[model samples]
Target: MKELLKRYKYAPADQLPSYCIPITVNGKTCGRLRPITPDTLHSEEEIRLLTEWRSASGEWFTTQFPVTEHGTRQWLEQQVLQADDRILFFVDDEDWNPIAQVGFLHYDEVKKQCEFDNLLRGRKGRFGNIMIYALLALGEWSIRVLDLQTGYLNVLADNARAIAIYKKLGFQEETRTPLVKQVEGDVTRWVVAEDDDTGGEAQRYLVTMKVRTEGFYETLKQIL
Candidate 1:
């Protein structure tokens, strides 16, 4: 039988079950990864999470998000589901429990470029590293199967942990810029060429990571 995650219901749970795609490394299906969604979009979450994330170290929620479950579900569906969008992968646990998600967004057939959106682990889970493994494998698959020019993500400058993780996965800083209207605040943009080994192989990933809503980062990593 094809493996699948056991369903679990939560507050106002109304969205579809998250997707799972097999990830192969060295010709073996080692794991899987979950991607970001519309309701789970980080355009705003990055900012909110940074506010509290800065105050604390490690991963754990200090407070609750302001939005309702129903509202969040509706919003994510609209934002994530679009033409030319192929996938978001959620890495599952040993018992087939989802623990994290990462999105490889805006697949451009003509330009051969796809952007890496959100990559986050659950507040409660045991397979955090599995998710990272899945994401890295997925990135390689995305490059080969999708015929991508480059894959990338925009991370908050202060998020040293995430930046470090990306670097280990063969991503490098392509550029950094200030977020509009916020003096002294900026987002570090990380980019990677498919075969990039020295960090800067030469290719422009065509995608703009932007904040679409205010204060949406805290819960933006959650599965809707």
Candidate 2:
């Protein structure tokens, strides 16, 4: 319940990277970025967002991962029950006020990957950048502190902005199957990955394709 802002020193329980942690960006306090637990669910603002996100059966959800109220309720209820499943984060302002929510849902422990989904911010513009910075900070914290080797996400293929951001953060297109159950009406799967376990060639291609191609070019040059 502590306000996580600007260089907050809080650490995660059980050393899991997905738990709530302190984060800051460019020397400014970013506030407490943590998992959405029943304990933290008491906030009115949090409850409001949860309700709206559920009711939003709007065009986005309908087009992306359509489901009924019952289905959505079941999933939200499970967030509190499943041990490995992390409601990754719903950030609050300094006063325990909910600002935006972003987290990895549908976690697959065996694969050490999860889908980075559900980001809702009340404000616009720089809000996206703040949430993204927070996510990367958590990624590093999870990797170094929790020993997680990889993270993955599924973005809406049409979401160019989000795709660009994930790419900028080093997530690459992947063929991994969708972890979330897609209703019959949903769209095709689109996924991305970041990890220590990427195949050597895949990693090379992802990290520096030009360099790899240049190496091949030099080899051919030498042959010629």
What is every candidate's alpha-carbon RMSD to the true fold? 13.2, 12.0
The global C-alpha lDDT for each of the candidates, from Candidate 1 onward, is: 0.46, 0.49
Candidate 2 per-residue C-alpha lDDT over 57-164 given as tens digits, one digit per residue, 9 for 90 to 100: 243331345445545445555653353455546665545456666765444546544555666555433344666666655665555544454566654444566667
lDDT measured at residue 28 in model 2 versus the true structure, 0 to 100: 64
Q: What pairs collide in candidate 2?
A: 4-31, 4-32, 5-31, 6-29, 6-30, 20-34
lDDT of 1 by residue, 46-143 (tens): 32432333234322111223334444444345544442354555565545555555665566667666667656665444434555566556655555
Return the TM-score for each candidate structure.
Answer: 0.54, 0.57
Question: How much is 176 displaced in model 2, in angstroms?
Answer: 9.0
What global local distance difference test value does model 1 have? 0.46
